[model samples]
Target: MLTLYVDAAREPNTGLSAAGAVLIHQKAQQQFKSPVFQSLDNHAAEFQGLIWALEQLTDHQDILTVYSDSKLLIEALHKHYAKHYQDQVDRILFLLASHRLVFSQWLPEKDNLGAHNLALQALKNRQTND
Candidate 1:
């Protein structure tokens, strides 16, 4: 099974957000993070992170499990609807169309340290670069 852990961070002061993820396949893991183009609410940021992580996948897998700390992102994906983030939901669905099987679960923050920390680092890096 291919598993991905995703998280997002937003700094209120700087109005900056970033996405982070840890992708694992066949016992090998890769971590990645990137700053979002625009600042958004936590919900939007989470969706962006998932989108970013999904885009990083090179090939299709039999099953893909995404672990995220944001309930809105997981539920939105499952239901294919997000009241305020409908555009993001559509973007996610389009990206997910290539996969045979994909699902997301709500992960506890404490257990999601890797992605959380990476997201923070992404935000920090973006801040410094600016």
Candidate 2:
């Protein structure tokens, strides 16, 4: 089984946002993180992070569980309802249904430390590269 934790952040006064995700396969004790530029709202970024994480999975047959701190995103996914960002929402939902993915809500930033730090580091790296 593979479990993933995801988070996203948007810079204040800037449209720029980044999404980050960390996947841990407990049985194998392996982990991975991905941080990418997301030219969208925080909600979109969160959903995108989940999608990105799912895309990284090596085995589609593995039991997949996704964790995120965004309640809105969790609720949306749980309800199978579409949000304003129809494209992103549709994409994520399609992936979830296709893979038979499981969704869970995680609160308290401490629990999502790795993904959060990766996102901030990605922002720093982007700035440095520019």
The global Cα lDDT (0 to 1) of model 2 is 0.70
Model 1, 105: alpha-carbon shift in Å?
A: 0.5
User: For model 1, how does the per-residue alpha-carbon lDDT over 7-74 read when each residue is reduced to its tens digit?
Assistant: 99988765579988998999999999885556567788888888888888886645888899888888
Model 2 CA deviation exceeding 4 Å by range = 27-35
Give the clashing residue pairs of candidate 2, or none.
none
TM-score of structure candidate 1: 0.93
After superposition on all CA atoms, what RMSD does each candidate show versus the true structure?
Answer: 1.3, 2.2
Clash count of each predicted structure:
0, 0
Note the residue pairs that clash in candidate 1. none
Lowest lDDT 10-residue stretch of candidate 1: 35-44
Ten-residue stretch with the least lDDT total in model 2: 27-36
